[model samples]
Target: MTFDVKKEEKQFYSAKGPELIKIPSMDFMAIRGTGNPNDEGGAYQRAVQTLYAVAYTIRMSEKAGISLPGYEPYVVSPLEGLWWQDGYAGVDLNKKSDFQWWSMIRLPRFASHEILDWAKNTAAEKKKIDTSDIQWFTYDEGLVVQAMHHGPYATEPETVSEMNDFVSDHELKEDFSTRYHHEVYLSDPRKIAPEKMKTILRHPVKK
Candidate 1:
């Protein structure tokens, strides 16, 4: 049955706002996006291309009536993504000279195997490369708290700080079992304008 995953009711925590609580360790497929440092335009375009490429593949597969176990797509990014940390997440922004940007699509842990199979093949075909261009992994099952950021990413620290406080108040500690701080992009400030930008910041938390 077709349903709106975005609208799907999920356990949530709200203090300053409603924080969507997603279980960690959901399997996901991602592209290691890199972009031109100076060519913000090119970087953005490429980022959009990569995001749509995978999203379309999943959507088309579902439309064609393909079924498998576990299914959902999340556009994952970093927590302090806008900052440049030299050899770290900052490297992607360095690619701007080459017209590249870093981004990725995170498939839900419950995403169907058939959907993943199709996504792999589809990415290879569209990007003119094989699996090398894509990286697939899984997120472990745990507590993840998320909320939408509606301003420039530079201003996200405040929002994240509040979210952290909320987690702490609720007796939740940061879950550091994983190496990555998960973020899902719901809006592209480069194109959508910051006033309307929406970024979902998710942190692994221990309840």
Candidate 2:
């Protein structure tokens, strides 16, 4: 059976409305960059491309006779990102040029630094793109308020406002001291209609 995070971890990935939850530490293949994500062929787009390259390489390692202990067939996790801006409190969609982001994909438990190194080398050779900036690390998001956002990315502020209201109603404050504004892309923009897109928006919060 292929393990799917969306199905196995529904609470984390499928929130329909603003709600509070705790996120545990998890491993990821990440690449950091700055600038507008909407820019064609930009740093953010390249970062995403590099992330998937290495992620798929590790996922298919067994077929290449590379096996790791406790490895199992699993679905590649959705694309997730951590976003922030310098000297800004919360994300400002209008100021995309000032955005700093960590585009990443969750890795399975069996993934290790050795496997990641191998994957990066293989992907770099096969794709003919630099993968030197990729990183493997664990992140603990802790307490957060998250909701499933509908519609296009430009309309995210509407959902964000609702989440902020929920946080205040619950006496929790948005905290970006350690964590970041997180997003989980559940629907591929290419296949899904913009008005029907689904994105999990998460904000770190503290009581």
Candidate 3:
């Protein structure tokens, strides 16, 4: 069976409402960019394409026999982002222009730093795009509260408000120093209706 992380890991998806989960360590191939994600011709859009290009190159590495140890066929994980800004208490949906995002793809456990380097070079050569900016990141978000947000991106505030209320009721404090507003995109907006799009929004917290 092909290893599908989304199907195998329950926490990789979302719940109907707010739920707290202890996240484990995970590696990623990350790229940083600043600009509005909605800009059709912006850095954010280009960065996302670059991420996927590299991810797919790495995923298909086995065919080249230039692969990582313990490599197995697995579905590519969803796109995830760490959203924040210079001095914002939280991500301001209204201010996409100033958004500082760490856009990333969760790497399989078998993928290592060297494997990623090879993938970056391979993708750059094949795709004829700059891949020098892509970096390796290992993150463990620890404890966080997450929920499914089903709506257009602009309507995320409503879901965020609910997440905040749930956090307060559970007596948890935001840990901005260690964590930031994070999101896992489960729906492709271009293919899904605005009201039906799904995003798993999560925030790290401390007791």
Top candidate by lDDT: 2
How many backbone clashes are present in model 3? Answer: 0
Clashing pairs for predicted structure model 2, backbone only:
none
- lDDT, candidate 1, equals 0.53
Q: Write the per-residue lDDT of candidate 2 for residues 61-155, one digit (tens) a residue.
A: 78879776778988999999999999888788778999999999999867889878888999999889899999986789999999999999999
By lDDT rank, best first, the candidates go 2, 3, 1
- The local distance difference test score of each candidate is 0.53, 0.91, 0.87
The TM-scores of all predictions, comma-separated, are 0.60, 0.97, 0.95
lDDT of 3 by residue, 6-62 (tens): 888966676779888888888899998888899987888888899999999978887
Which candidate wins on TM-score? Answer: 2
lDDT of 2 at 17: 86
Could you tell me the TM-score of candidate 3?
A: 0.95
**What lDDT is reached at residue 185 by model 2?**
97
Candidate 1 Cα errors over 4 Å, as ranges: 10-24, 33-48, 61-103, 106-115, 126-131
